[model samples]
Target: MGGKGHIFRKKLFQVGSEYKWLGNSGELKEITLEKRTGVTKELIEKRIKLVTTGIDYHLGHRNCEHFAYFVTGNMPRSDQSIWHMFTDHDPFNIQPMINNFDQLREALLRSKHCGPVGLSRGDFENAVFVSQLDDGYYTYHLSHPLGGQHLYITTVEKAKNFESSYNSIVLAYFGAFFGRGEIFSIVRQLRGC
Candidate 1:
């Protein structure tokens, strides 16, 4: 819980009823509690219970960022984990490929998990594409062979709508036959999208 410097190098362990060494200045980078609402004493108690339970820490899944989110009664997630997943270096120190829409799209298309179903790659290429909005949300577009096009905002519900109307064959970044709904669902399950 406490270390001399560089808190990331410290192993998390409970000391008696409390976590020790939490007073280090290194631990106070970006405090998110100020941005949250509906955080109550009960929520703090819940976080204390979670801490006292001796949960195993995994850097990619359960780090200090996750703990801070949990303490605020929000879903536990770590931007550090997402950053690590996309790059070899610290996110603050280097720009990751994920920041480039073209690079990210190309990388996703090359993923073994992504491709077209029942259609040739050329057909898939002409029919479907993914676009990222200025707000950072991804939108999936499908061009029908008959001349019309459908655009879906990438939310789980909208993905379901796309699935039901498109014969569940929308091209996605994760699966050949699955629609954006499947991708969003998988992301939601992972709790990091």
Candidate 2:
């Protein structure tokens, strides 16, 4: 884990703070309070309170960044190593789950935007996935598959609620930590697709 990244992300979540977003590509962007949306101190606190028992922000953020990188393929380059620290910790048994991504995708299709998440038995308990349809509505799940040793899909609402406690914290942390301009740049690039 990059010591600099860990310290940076930690400071970003220190409450009432600001920082410049530095991309892994070495691009620099400014972040400020006036420009950020969908992220607030209240939301952070609320989400922090919702995490499952025994889970803390440290562990939760690790899980969140790992999943985000897996899905987005972006290594979160904001001078924050929450992403790096997350991977270093290897919070989830993701290595084994890579092959399971197909199973996850298939389960997602069957559930029609509601499931394909939740804890299964063993090291591969927790999971997360996105659900979207023709409607503008979209939701993401963080859960453990139910029953058996193999993966299964649970409802998005449940997964979302589960993630609300900590996953939301990580999202908000990155959003705030990276600031508005940097986020817009990334979002715009993503939308161009």
Candidate 3:
């Protein structure tokens, strides 16, 4: 994290002294938050002190991303944690249920005035294919043996939400469409359909 011409980060080994100053790493990407005031060095140092003293360094709950967000006066959040919450692929331990896939798909499909997307079902069976169209819109495609569907997301927020819920959506689709059948039974059902 860089601000006011200095670069620093919360390193892993330094528990109590986590904040390390790395004089100007030219790789700082500026994050613009509207109505944010200039953060003073004293304020940053205070935050760092509070964090290094009070918070235990936990990868999932309190990491560098959380520190950065906290010091910047934004709601402290870890993008990695958020991503893991959505996409942890442990089959035996799926995340909490997100039950709005059908409704979201229906809404998007109804709003977007496209006929069936030309991609074959096999092209997107295992994953949701996300791509940015020439007009800056995003497309998410998911296909099954029965059919295929795509949603044109106009905003990045919606696109991210869809992508994050992609696995759940796929699972929900199969679960609803195929019932509680095993793989062979699902295949048989599909064939019978």
Which candidate comes out best when scored by TM-score? 1
What does candidate 1's lDDT look like per residue over 36-93, in tens digits?
3567878766665554232334466456776666666666667777633532222121
lDDT score, candidate 2: 0.31
TM-score of each: 0.26, 0.19, 0.25
- TM-score for candidate 3: 0.25
Residues 1-193 of candidate 2: C-alpha lDDT, one tens digit per residue? 3111121332222224655666567665555533343455565555444333322223323444443342233342223443453223222222111123343344333332232223323322243333332232222222223221222233233334544332322121012322323323222221211
Show model 2 residue runs off by greater than 4 Å.
1-18, 21-37, 56-193
| C-alpha positional error of residue 65 in candidate 2 after TM-score superposition, expressed in Å | 2.0
| Whole-model Cα lDDT of every candidate shown, in order | 0.43, 0.31, 0.38
Q: How many Å off is the CA of 141 in candidate 2?
A: 22
Residue 36 in model 1: shift from native, Å?
3.7
On lDDT, the stronger of 1 and 3 is 1
The 10-residue segment with the lowest total lDDT in model 1 = 88-97
Residue 59 error, candidate 1, Å? 1.4
